[model samples]
Target chain A: MDLSTLSLGQYTFVQNAFSFGLAVMAAATLFLWFSRSHVAPAYRMAITISGLVTAIAAYHYLQIMLSWEAAFSAVGGTLEVTGYPFNQAYRYVDWLLTVPLLLVELILVMRLSKSETVSKSVTLGGAAALMIVLGYPGEVSEDAGTRFTFWVLSMIPFIYIVYQLVVGLKGSISKQPENVRGLINGAATLVVVSWLFYPLVYLFPLIGLTGGAAVTAVEVGYTIADIVAKAVFGILILTIAMRKSEAEGNS
Target chain B: MDLSTLSLGQYTFVQNAFSFGLAVMAAATLFLWFSRSHVAPAYRMAITISGLVTAIAAYHYLQIMLSWEAAFSAVGGTLEVTGYPFNQAYRYVDWLLTVPLLLVELILVMRLSKSETVSKSVTLGGAAALMIVLGYPGEVSEDAGTRFTFWVLSMIPFIYIVYQLVVGLKGSISKQPENVRGLINGAATLVVVSWLFYPLVYLFPLIGLTGGAAVTAVEVGYTIADIVAKAVFGILILTIAMRKSEAEGNS
Candidate 1:
């Protein structure tokens, strides 16, 4: 987004979101990492992956926040673009690495057949990677046609991923322990809904929003999604692990 | 991940990742071999496997770095992809040898019953070798369908190995002296998590990252995973061996 100018409120709103996103990620990383012992050994890898996702997200949010502060000069009453350019690659890079892993952790926790887990993880992970990588060009493009074209390209994989998450994983989630069955569904739905939210935020600029408002909507919208997809969703995954761990007779 | 368009920054990122990876492996090899005397005689083989894993990884990193330099020309102000096809086979070859040893080291250090050790080692190591062998065809394939097919083939062994590491090893880890159990879990998680990361990075090219970006992601991503899975993981194993030795009353 081309943020030529911003009011103090808009600037701070994004800043707050970034800070909050960073905090959520940091907290989630520690929570998941240290709690590894609480779960049975079989489920540790899944929870560990959830910790990894947040740890990487925490790093990106930190860098993105610094970039946000650098690009906008808010020291004085004037809010103007600075000589330093903001790097948007951090968000895409984070998504590229973490999105696939998110699917992986979910698949790992399900305790599916070895072949099925392998099959689902590779297919779903590859699709998630495709969706993130495809979205990057359109995200950085200034032209409407370019943005719209890439959006459609990225959506192809996005649809595939969501279908797999919902329909493909339906049977697996049902086979989970009775206690975590609802939470597992919640986790899957949370992933789909949060992922769906990302494209809408990507469309803020294409859908008539421009300038500072577009920038704010896109940034804030993404922060909310980031928190939901990584941290809140991670906590949900962790809770499922804990429940399954308890069911298996572990304290 | 074929080398093509590259900015100076992207070129350097891969170069730097290679160099750092090389340094870690080289350092790890020396550290493991020299430190081997500190562990009990029974655990020495485990530490020896650590050295072997890092030593093999180090050689590959050196070759990989050289290939990377040969594949790209950045002597002048202009940066360009050059004639040399960066030999990625070095990685597969390295993994083919060391991956089996990775599991062998873990199993040996656990000090399992000789019969159980032989059985688990043969099974896990064979699976590891099969995983790497199955993965190479897909790695070299240009078609997405071919890559996906081989990825599925490889995941079959990957899932079996993970099961052995998690469920199969759970009872064994619990039987270990308290000090090194956490370290063992860390090592296992590191292997699984890093191994999982490699597949997703392999998908980068197939997904949408083309030309320079795909090459950059694959190169840097693999380098990072290599350091973690081989060198860093080797050290973790070494530490566990030392702790176990001490717990056995060896200074």
Candidate 2:
């Protein structure tokens, strides 16, 4: 269950997944930051928040990757795992930070009133962070029942987050320019759909894939979801903000 | 290596990667086909080509995934890998078909003169397909020298693709409305940068990571590039085409 026990393949998959995610987060952070000049001033805050989300994720993924490397080095290349440990807590720490900022970026781009934005962002962001913190225990649990329990508990906040996005934000989304409304809705849809992968990934072990298959599925699934949730979704936000910025500039 | 030797991690990774690519491609194809009401008639051809690129890749990825499944079924939980053969040619085949179409999609979006569009698309598309065909032999080569030689050959065409996008297409891109021009340029840059990963991935084996590390880097790297080149870039193209479509409607 530790570094020495992992096959070279497992190690490589985990290592590459984190490294690639880190690279993407870093690149997206830079892109979001530099794109400010091309967007309207009103949309700058959203852009900043998007950059902050990826920047934070990049730092945390680096920590996770380094932790993995340290664990791997402790055991060398032997396949008999004894006590080498990796710190998966880094991922929880990352989601705790990035997930909230993700919601905030969405809210800011919506251009809601100050009070409405504050209330909505705080509520949704809190739920997002809570979902991550709550899911961690489940992810590391050895007992399937314990894992499922934490998963169900995490779903409470996840459902609320989805509700807030799909229903709670509907009015604001509908009010956007017709062309952009589809994109805003699409962004929200992406959040809901991509996050669903987390729960599915959590169930990999329950279905009796406790070996490399389960691990591979979980790591690869999460990697794909993370890219979609963070980078791809970030681009969607940029598009929305850019269109809005241009509209304002022209008018 | 054949199917028998592939680790569960490898099987799972390949299966998941192809499946996910298929889903993204299918979704994009549906989106393009259904969104005709939202785009100008002139832009629809570009959108359709974007859809075609994904559609072709999707079909190929499905074949790749099915081949993996068949290979897995043959082994039936025997950890020792044997003579289960899975064809990687599926990738080369897919790329050969889709890469050219990718360039054509870009050329189409420019709304250049009929003769100019046909000439540029044919030239660029041919170069893109040749790049893939030339690289395939290197990918499967045993000797580092042979791989490098083929890589250099591939790069010749890659360099030409970049030149075409940057210099050859400059006039058409520059003539776009200011805002859309930025996106069009960004799209061109996305092609250049994302394609750069292909070469770096090629160097994985030369760097002495010839085992799981090499395989991991190549697969994960290509998956990331494919997403950017096809899905992410397709979205950018859609954004540009949509904006131009809207401008036309308004004017």
Candidate 3:
């Protein structure tokens, strides 16, 4: 947990995580900003909410980067940068806010009945926040048992989210225009697959990987997963939304 | 480069890369196999060829993993696992064979005129192979200047491939069945974007990151990019092919 003791490799790994996170944040923001006008009125709320998720994430990542830089500077030339443990709290905060909205946007883009949208988003989104809240304890837990327990607890909601997307929403997704049915399935599956990484990351210590190896694996894994889940998933959602909007116009 | 000399961190990095590559290979192969029956007759060749690309890469990655394990055992248990430099030649070998085929599959799936497909595949695929071949010397070069020189040289072909995909193929792509045009464009753009990582990976050593840091960066970067380029691109290609074939059938 001490930033002062990190090896150069670990330092680079964390820095790269921040860089990757920030890049995704910026790219997603720019994409949503530029493309929002092109989305349909029915889909515009989803697009705007998508932009909000990235914008919020971008801000939080900037704070994390600053924390990283501060820690790096305090250590001067030494790879074992001393001082504050870069507060990763910013990431949890970011996810707590954005994760639920991710599901909300998906629901919004689907154009289900208002009551259906509200009920699904509230239930799924609340579970998403709880997933983050539960997983955070495991992420910070030093004991293997505690981490494993938290991981299992988090997966309860994670599994539910996947089930809701895969089974519960199957009908709604099928009702989408044929052109976008494949993409709708792809987006849902992408979320389920990518979100599975968090629990895997939490179990790294149990697998006997500690120090820089564990650190690098967890950070890099999460970064890759986030890119797929947030940035790539967002793009898929946009594509589906655009296609459906166009289809409705033609019809 | 010495597997025996690798720190545990380096060992883990290489092992993770191998795992990732093999996983991608298996996933892509399984996807193509399962979907082959469903894809249209005209598009079957592309799906089959896509599976071949991953199958070939998987076999090569298995070899790379064996070489790594051999080196690790020879080094014994020391963190400073010194001596044997794990051969990365397998990667270049894999790319040389598969990169060209990637382009060919793309061309095939598009179902362009036979003459156009042949010419574009030969030119683009040949250039893709050349890019990897040209870049390999620089990858192993101890001298940064040699590395940068070769990296830039490789970019000549890389740029041409991009140009061919983006500009030269524009007309042909535009003629694709209307429903799948966006998907086709997405696939082509994915290729151009993902391939850009190669030159960037080449520049890592030049930026004063050497040894394990540079190795990990380059390997991890390439793995991520390759997944995007090959596996993800294959999926996009399949989706496009499926949609187009379905549209044709309905018409």
Candidate 4:
């Protein structure tokens, strides 16, 4: 499992894959942004946000791959020097960047469809501000304590998203939009599942589950799940955006 | 790791939780069906499908909990077992039931907006059918050969999903909705990440990654992911359904 032992060719391959993925993601974001004006205004915002979030995630992953190589080089081909901070930084950056975007996308979709009662523009503006406040600092440090602090700060927005989803689901259900309720429920499920990992990561050390491959596996598993959540929610938001535009065109 | 020594109270707690979850799911289904006429026809169908799928998953989890108790009792109050066929059955059932619904939900959303091209529907339909076929026999046995077959078959729908998503993403980028493209990309990412476990689970025997807590953890992790996926996608479908209805109402 000593990743540092990887040959130069293998290291280059990993680095290339990471960079290429990020590049494609950036291209996708720009493409989406340019096309936004052709669609409904609300959906335009949703796609824009989705694109930005995807770019952020791609950047974070790229950083992880680069750091992996750097840490390996630092150890001169040894895996024992503890690049754990790099790993932690990757996870924190991921959560801070993607989760709030997901929330905003949902709200924008609801608002575009006129299903949301609140002034969505104002709410979304507030959420964006909160995301910057929470996420920016999270990406600044790989220190365990600082990362943990940012994670707690990040939870404030996470909780707000959950509340919005619950209320949205209820409102949609009241209007007999059972399908929307179902979608919100699904997105909320991921939020809850992703959050479940946080306490485990932070609290497991207290219960002595904080070492070895088990801990590593937990971290990896959570990271993968978070990625899946982003991907799934991102698509859901995109679908909503498209539907909103089509409706506008028809009208 | 022998689960057989569990006191009556622990078993009862699991049993009750399973039952309560199932009952709530059942009620949700009935309510969904009953509310159909009050909603738009397209969304009505989506809601029905989503509700049914969720109910099925809840039932499978309940069955797993009950079977775990049965296995414990059969083995003279010990949790250790030679194999966990019942657990495997539940897992396959959960996948077989949900993956198709997810595909169908996506198609349904497009259909609601009357934006789906015929070829896209055909492709999605074919994938949905394959998921059911692969998933059905997966629940039959937990033998290594059977498990391998199940995993291979399951991959068909997953791969198809990835393909459809790629196509959809490209299409959205070129001419259609930006949000739709975003959603497809997101779903494609999840499909890839979730299926990463298939090879791991199937190949672990060859690599000697099997046994005790490791095996249990993998199985449980997959199950949780499955549940989370179903819940999230189910909600997404609901969102699309609601948005479509709102559009119709406004029109």
TM-score of chain A of each: 0.96, 0.91, 0.91, 0.63
What is the C-alpha lDDT profile of model 4 across B114-157, one tens digit per residue?
55534555677678657657755643544657756876887777
lDDT of 3 at A3: 43
**Per-residue CA lDDT of candidate 4, range A1-251, in tens?**
23334455554555565565556555655665566655664455566666656656665666556555544443564334233223334545354445555666666666634534346544643664474456445434435567567667766765665576566455553553444545555655766666556545554443445434444455455445555565555666665556555755731
Kindly state the fnat score of candidate 1: 0.00
Query: Runs in model 2 with CA error above 4 Å?
Result: A1-251, B1-6, B73-78
Positional deviation of residue A246's Cα in model 4 after best superposition, in angstroms: 34
lDDT of 4 at A111: 64
Cand 4, B chain, TM: 0.66
Model 1 chain A: ten consecutive residues of lowest lDDT: A81-90
Candidate order by DockQ, highest to lowest? Answer: 1, 3, 2, 4
DockQ for every model, please: 0.05, 0.01, 0.03, 0.01
A1-251: candidate 2 lDDT, tens digit per residue: 32334677776887799899999988998898788667776677677667767766776677667656755543565444322245455556567657887898889898998789879987998899789878977876778899999999999999999998889898888888886898999999999999898788778778776665566556667777988998888889999999987777731
Task: Indicate whether candidate 2 or candidate 3 has the larger TM-score.
Answer: 2
- Taking the tens digit of each residue's C-alpha lDDT, what string does model 3 give over B68-139? 664554346556432333556666766876788789888998898868886888799889989988987887
The C-alpha TM-scores of every prediction are 0.58, 0.57, 0.56, 0.43
- Which residue pairs in candidate 2 have backbone atoms (N, alpha carbon, C) closer than 3 angstroms, thus clashing? B3-B84, B4-B81, B4-B82, B5-B81
- Candidate number with the higher TM-score (1 or 3): 1
Q: Which regions of candidate 4 are displaced past 4 Å?
A: A1-251, B1-39, B73-87, B112-157, B168-200, B248-251
lDDT of 2 by residue, B33-131 (tens): 544445788888888889888778778867876775555542333334334556667888888988898888888888889999899988999999889
By DockQ thresholds, what CAPRI class is model 1? incorrect
Q: What is every candidate's alpha-carbon RMSD to the true fold?
A: 12.8, 14.6, 15.7, 19.3
Model 1 CA deviation exceeding 4 Å by range: B1-251
